[model samples]
Target chain A: MSIGQETVLEANEARVVYNEDSDNPVEAVRSISLDLRKGEVLALVGPSGCGKTTLFNAIAGLIPLQGGRVSVGGIEVEKASGHVGYMLQKDLLLPWRSVIDNVTLGLEVRGKPKGEAKKIAQELIERYGLGGFEHSKPSGLSGGMRQRVALMRTLAFEPEVILLDEPFSALDFQTRILLQSDVKRIIREEGKSVILITHDIGEAISMANRIVVLTNRPATVKTVHEVPWGDEVTDPVAVRDRPEYQEMFSTIWQELELTNGQQGKTMKGAA
Target chain B: MAMATDIGEAKKQTAAPPAPKRRPRNSTGRLRIMAYQVAVLIAIVAVWQIGLWTGTLKPYVYGTPWGVMQAFAEQIANGTLLRHFWVTGQEVIIGFVIGCSLGSLCGLMLWLSPLWAKILHPYMIALNGVPKIALAPLIIVWFGLGMESKIAIAAIITFIVAFLQAYKGTQEVDQDLIRLMKSLGATQWQTFRKIVMPGSVPWIVSALRLNVGFALIGAVVGEYISAEEGLGYMVYYAGQLYDLDSVWVGIFSLMFMALILEAVVARIEKMLDMEK
Candidate 1:
């Protein structure tokens, strides 16, 4: 963890409340803040339904924050729209579009010329090992292939920061392991900062340079652990082989369980 | 992570290519089914013909199949049936095109504003509830007794069905897809063009198929009230003269028109499908 590295993204006192106008407003996130160093992989891990996705939406600027602010490379999230590339849990590919067309969607939306967008998308497809599948529809691809295509689509725009919201949650166990390594290698080679949200402790241990543990709804940062491997080991498989990996995994696992216990105590008090 | 020692130990293996589907060539079974259908038709016609010859059926009320065939031949020779067929065909084509385009455009446009859609929802439902056929006389009075009135009726009938189906389709588009579009820096217009429009296509095509029947019904009903031409007028004139054979000919001609229109719509659907 180098303190001198420049910060690429920052969220300060961010909060979100669903149904804000209703009598019973639901607080999703409460006063959460974090920062990502340039070229760092930051993982946010928490228990299921802990409003992690709500926090991701806030960072991506898809939903407005009720309080506080999120900014990218010193620009406000709203004005820094194109600087962040978001990869959702589902592939969300346009079914009618071909592989090349889906990969170029962000570029096209940004008003890039058709020929130039296609050219950029084509280079990415070839570089990412999807060269022959340029014209294939999303329905024809397997789950792993679809997710890879989605990552490629995000990378095509070359955004300074990429937000991955449970990108591998929908995959089978074996596929998830392989894709974790593949995605980590790609992100490392590209030198782009990333904020990955996941519930899997092992995944956060394997891929992130630093892990942020969040509490249950009205989510706030509970703890932050700096991975032992840091930037020295870029491979996820190699990260798993480290002796400290299991220790880190259990520590985060206990922290998540503590969150659940706190939530249960609150529920009992209300009852 | 080290505790999960066997995470990537699975050998790299390629999945086998999926088996090609063998289309069922049940020619023999299909032939058997066709034979039975033909037998049923033959039995029905034979019984009708026999009933006429034996005086069990009244000839004046139930015209013989041969007599109806002769009436078709007579009209073809005189060219009267062809003229009437052409008139009805033109009315159906023009009215269907006008109604279908306007209805679909208006329906899709409603997606632009939630407030506008909410305000107009009940009015659309009420207008759709009224039996469009009941408006034929008034439509005739407005558009005149000629083909214009018949066209107006056909257009009006087809409009509601297309409008409702397309509006529902617009509403049914996946909200997540729109969210994705916005995240990618797409404008409101881009979201509609890329996501909403393509998503609603299946609904619009189905509406076109359903409206084919409505368009024909509108044309016939309009002609039934007042017209000098069209198959409906031919049927009415034959009934006045007690020409049951000619009446059957007119009814059968309209059936053929329906089949042809349906085939045309199916062809258009295939074309749209290819674009995807």
Candidate 2:
């Protein structure tokens, strides 16, 4: 990963099953085992409704793991509260709060002093391009601006690892590409480890150091691809031009198609 | 990195055309509406005046507008109308505040326990269905014939509506926001304070609007049962004495009071909208 050999996050055969005690239990995540190195961007790309969110929730400790362990910095996720900051696809900004207030939400919930939290949040706002819009409410901002505030909110808490769940899936293409570049720069500058979840192969190829492909529901790791471009390549457009990006995209696309076909066969078998 | 340039470009593209301005409503259209309202009032007054002059209506029974105006002048001169106005105003305001506070507090507390909410749901619905005005006599008996009775009636009337509204608001707060709070390592109390309370504001404001009117009803009903002062007592006393003009004056005063309270609630709603 270029920064260190130390692992920041590890998911060892972590499994999640929904309605486990019910008559018909659904296995969402059968098994996922992966390690995220320090200062690395790892992307988990899977088909739609393929238990990606289930895995994300497990890592965030929002839900309990049915079996096995998901740990952050060697601490089990369930015990490691406030160690991982999570960003959802939707910005989920508090409409009543101003930009600065939303950014400091994590700190406020953490019971940090108001003045100290505001100072920390203020630096992030000014350092980013949202300096003048500190007092502006979320409704006044554009979609892209809201997402930026969401990122700032995640970053303000200074968690050991950040999890982004399809952070750009809501944006239009033009806004998405520009934001992708902006986010990459911000994460790189802060030297934060991130686990990005998306269904977009192009996004995974452009952003992550290592891309983990996942199968359909009861998701298991299909393949893991290491991007040839190193940390120096943060711009998505630049990454797309590289021969490696094109080659890796097709390979992942084929793997995903195979998983979808297998899922249909399994459904037929059940019926 | 072209971070600054990217932001500048993004701002330019996403700056959608300021929502079409609403045309300032056209002064002539506003003036026309005002003219129509005044014309309607003039027509009603003219019809009443003509009827009185032609002897189609008796002045004693169907009191003339001029007689009602004279009654208003007499009350103002003697200062009894103002005294009654102040008494009713105090009862309405005090009862509304108490009822809204206690009711909403109970309603919000219900959110802390689902089992309690389930247990109390049917009882709350049944209690609300019992016409509170019917309990005015009982309320008068319990709280006495003074302003306390009127205040008690007002509080009782408004309490249930406020309770129902605030409870519904607590239930309706976005579930995703709660999930977000949990992910942030927030305790249940923190989630309630930051997310649930603020999210419930729109519903609570609606309750305030509805309950202000309900509080007024309770106060008037309480005064109807037994009171020496208040517009309701004034109207009842005038009717007993066959003073039609004075009765009309009391009724108009009550209408004016309701309009003012409604405007205040509307102003609060506007302020909340702007803040959010």
Candidate 3:
């Protein structure tokens, strides 16, 4: 690896293990190395049990990595820091807080006076279609709208890197595409780096500049698809429907085909 | 608890929530609720008065509300009512303030230290189960029948309830929100202050509102054990003297005091609801 590009997040031989108190503790992630350049989206794509979330956890400092190091902006992050923002599966909006107040939470914790943060948050809310809803509580919004508020919250802090742990997985199919497109536009306009954790191959293909494919539990990087649509991609759903998208999907599918088979058996039995 | 919540909800049909508006139940649901409560009181008294009339009920066993009212008038005329009422109010106010603060602080401390939480959790739970009256003597022995003793008893009663709830409230903070804050690089204290504290506000307020009753009970009961002059002491004296009316007056005064304190604390909770 040249290691020359402006890397925002680098996980060198990052390993993670679930240290269950039980005797047979399972390894969640095994020896993974990856680099996400600034202003780029690096999507982690794999099967259901492929340790994608585990890797994201390791990177975000949500879990302690058993091996190697993860850094943000060249500084080691032993614990998850505000330098990165993680939009969860749900919007995770503070239900009591108004949409604008939820967005300004990070700033408030950082001791930014509320007045300034609120103005910036208001602008972001209005800019990204949450204008009238600023004064509303999280309960008032739909799933898609809630996610938008959450995205705005993550964006408000202006972190160097944002970690998205299946941020759109909760919404139905149609809402997912719209919010995903809005998110893509916001990311580009702001020029922040993102590490998107998703199982959907199509999602990986359309939005990411590079897709990191991983094996099931004890996962390591299987391949990196230097995706082709970085310049051509505009609409998230449109790009997701493109022919190349299907091609990218099959390629990663073939790589994780074996792990997917095992996962299918366990999931079937569990269900 | 379910009945209490339902009663609270049923009374507040007009509470607004266009902007996270806090819905208070009009402090025990207004004087109408009190009227309903009074009706129940009257029905019980009517049964007792009939029992007295029929000679089936001993006067010593149950006194009529009218009889209690008569005794109340006598105390009012003699001016002993003012003395005991003032003393009881002072003890209750002082005990309430001390108890509530200690309980709230204990709650915070327990929530912050999991190690101590593990060790003390069982003890706290055990104490809550034990009759606070059972320990009243022990408390008096330790702190004396002075105001400190009364306050201490009240604090113990209030603290257990407050700590259990506040600890649970602190623990009940949304995990996803904490994760989001962590991913955003917020420090532990930042997460606690911004996310944890704010999340616990509603729970804390409700707990505080509840502790008001417990604190009052603590002060009153402690006074009953051995106080020179207090509402509880006055009631004890009246019962001993066979003045059932005076005893009844003291009890009613206590209910009135409890209602007033609840209203004030509830108002304070509402003012702080802007956190939402």
lDDT of 3 at A113: 89
Positional deviation of A160 in candidate 2, in angstroms?
1.1
B98-204, model 2: which lDDT tens digit per residue?
A: 98888888878777777887777667666656776888898899999999999998898778777776777777777777878888889888988999888877767
The per-model DockQ list reads: 0.47, 0.57, 0.61
Task: Give the TM-score of each candidate.
Answer: 0.89, 0.88, 0.84
Give the runs in model 2 whose Cα sits over 4 Å from its true position.
A268-271, B1-40, B50-62, B127-130, B237-244, B270-276
Ranking by TM-score: 1, 2, 3
What would the per-residue lDDT of candidate 1 be over residues B87-156, giving only the tens digit for each residue?
Answer: 9999998999998888888878888877887787667666666777888888999999999999998898
lDDT of 2 by residue, A1-271 (tens): 3556899999999999999999999999999999999989999998899999989888888888999998898888883267888888899999899999999999999999999999999999999999999999999999999999999999999999999999999999999999999998899889899999998899999999999999888899999999987777889989999998889999999999999899889989999
TM-score of chain A of each: 0.95, 0.97, 0.91
**Candidate 3 segments whose C-alpha is farther than 4 A from its true place:** A1-5, A20-25, A247-257, A264-271, B1-60
lDDT of each: 0.85, 0.87, 0.77
Prediction 3 global C-alpha lDDT:
0.77
Could you give me the TM-score of model 2 versus the true structure? 0.88
| DockQ ranking from best candidate downward | 3, 2, 1
* RMSD to true structure for each model, in Å: 8.8, 8.1, 6.2
Of 1 and 2, the candidate ranking higher by DockQ: 2
